[model samples]
Target chain A: MRELSITTEACDTGGCPVRVVRVSGYIDAHSFPRFEREILTLVNQGNNRLLLDLRNATYICSTALGLLMSVFRQVRHNAGDLVIAGMSEKIANIFNLLGISKLIQAFPDEEEALRCLAAAEAS
Target chain B: MTTRRRDLALMVPGEAEYLCLVRDLVTTVARKAGFPDCRIGEIEIAVDEACANIIEHAYGRRPPGEPHVGKPQAIAVRLALFPDRIEVRIRDRGRCFPPEMASSLDIAEFAASGRRRGIGSYIIRSFVDEVHHSYRPGRGNELTLVKYLAKGVPGG
Candidate 1:
């Protein structure tokens, strides 16, 4: 398959705007710049409530993780939030081991994460 | 009968595009060595981080007056499988990574700092049981990482 592919979708749930970004393949140092660019472009365009879908993503290097955290901080700064969905157990375990799970919430699938984020935004 | 130990070696150019090959080799061998899926995943990341570091911190950090600006470098990775653990040694002829900078910052603090680098060291440490880095004047820089199998895990 490809080294990395990122696709985004705009969704409005309960009057809350959320963008679902689906990533597949490996996110190593080579592809991280593109990943960062895509996220930053969306954020700059005011699409900051991001639900990152990693169901098909096979791997994520630490630098990419760091960039995710950096982007998360930026989203929060803009009064928005970033959450994860449909990540493999391996990725989830890695996040937990690195203390990233504590800062970001992950759900089993995109629907659940979108629902929760919408609820959280509505409240 | 005792399980035979296996030693595997690979040499890849120090470039980001070849990292997937390294990860695939390490994980495939780890699985055949009887490592559980989770442990295999950890090994994959550790080895990937080491090679990626070689690509970035080692070869990427060249001096201003360096002559071989675009010269290709290679990373040598050796994987030895024992009855109780797996050991990985990655060697490169580039600058030695700073030992003092190997520690991980709090993820939140790191994110807030807006820094995109430095987390590779943390992932390497967190995934492997032991880590060692040594540099030789004529040889190169070698990083060794070990991850012990859990009790009762079958030998390779």
Candidate 2:
């Protein structure tokens, strides 16, 4: 099965570590483990502040949202934070309907989300 | 016996591995039936979720990453194309699920729960126009999703 492509770049801005994971393609029940494993691995590596970029994701199923929640809970449990950015229109609609756009830390793009995470870390 | 008519049918092992195949089949059938792109995406997702639920709950399989024991089950998905709508029935010869699981989704509560487990069934119920579930005792379980096409839409 073709899984979501996960490219994680670790950035340290003024002593704050933010792991930006850019995911492309579909995120569903079958493919969510790839996304989940990446985030869990990053969290294990101490890159707690996270920015999951889904702008290029073709689709995000509700099960994938659960995967995101697992990552969110993991980051929060470790006293770190997580945010998402670059949601495609379809993904954004699903997020909006599920209240994720309102409940989670979200931004229009990676840059904005990185800035927010870094700023929060600095505070 | 649940007697009915079906236009297309496809079956896959009740494992998460074959969800894409089911989704692709749904997409092709929905496209041939003249569903709009957006609506087609919704149908694809809803069907995917239905199949997923069948794989998990019906077959009694654990979530991904957990060690699965014993043999995998099989899930059958059928489609019925009609003039005003499309109906999809997903069947599994595994354990039966509660008929009440097809209840309406509470978006607010679901989000408040951190968007956890119930999202799959919720999405299946939300995106599709109608959803229904039936249990055949020791036989199996069947979940159906329906999407109504707009009037005068081509291929209807």
Candidate 3:
């Protein structure tokens, strides 16, 4: 089994102010602590705009989904936004079925999510 | 005519950290039970959620200031693969899950509530054909999940 990890990089898209968080491998209760710490560190660092890349992530338990929601809310609280991209169809449908899709914006890829991050911010 | 049946049992300490191993075994069993790849994914997720609840609710996450009771409890799962349905039973002795919690949940209400919890039961019921839980005084709780095979699918 692969280990879970959260790594980051900062990129500016026409002054859009975006931070990319790439999550991979299995993320469950055991690994959620590191995941939460890294994301909150960014939020507390004032990097509000975020693009989450989950193409490589294999499994995301409910705890992880909740963590994502927490981060999304925190970002919005600071007048910023977050969009996720590259989820497997099955994973995306889980989020959709739970209605998380209604609150969080998701895209097929990072590029599309980036293109619409600002637009989604209006919601 | 006679058909063959297969059953497997696993017992692990009631804790969240061991779910990764449980998911792997469940996926393997589901795959061998003739479930499609997509269905296997659903089974894996549903079982993970079920076990997570057992760890969190049954065993109770060591309260902030309280010490654990000597050692954590144990949860056991039994998988029975038949020609008609794949049945899984998870048994725990720590605490009994409310019978109603396994019932269908209102997605809209859950969303509006802004809560991250309570979605596991829904997922388990959604992914499988049927879910049933039984409890006995001080005996234990058993949560059974069943996924029916498609018509014409061979199990024997």
Please tell me what DockQ candidate 3 reaches.
0.39
lDDT of 3 by residue, B12-129 (tens): 8787667888888888888887877666777788788888888778777754335457876888989888887778889999677753444565544554455667666667767777
Real contacts retained, model 2 = 0.37
Chain B TM-score by candidate, in order shown = 0.81, 0.78, 0.82
TM-score of each: 0.90, 0.79, 0.84
Which candidate gets the maximum TM-score versus the true structure? 1
Once fitted onto the true fold, the runs of candidate 1 whose alpha carbons sit more than 4 angstroms away are B1-4, B61-71, B98-104, B151-156
> For candidate 2, what is the DockQ-based docking class?
acceptable
Once fitted onto the true fold, the runs of candidate 3 whose alpha carbons sit more than 4 angstroms away are A118-123, B1-4, B63-69, B99-112, B151-156
Query: Model 1's A-chain: what TM-score?
Result: 0.95
Query: In candidate 2, what are the lDDT values of residues B37-138, reduced to their tens digit?
Result: 667777887788777767666676677776557666788988998767788988888776753343455555665466567766656767777778888887
DockQ of each: 0.55, 0.33, 0.39
| Cα deviation of B132, candidate 2, in Å | 1.7
Clashing pairs in 2: A55-A86
lDDT of 1 at A112: 96
| Residue-wise C-alpha lDDT for candidate 3, range A29-122, written one tens digit per residue | 6777788788888988999998989998878887777767767777777888878999887677677666778888888998888778655544
Highest-scoring model, lDDT: 1
Candidate order (DockQ):
1, 3, 2
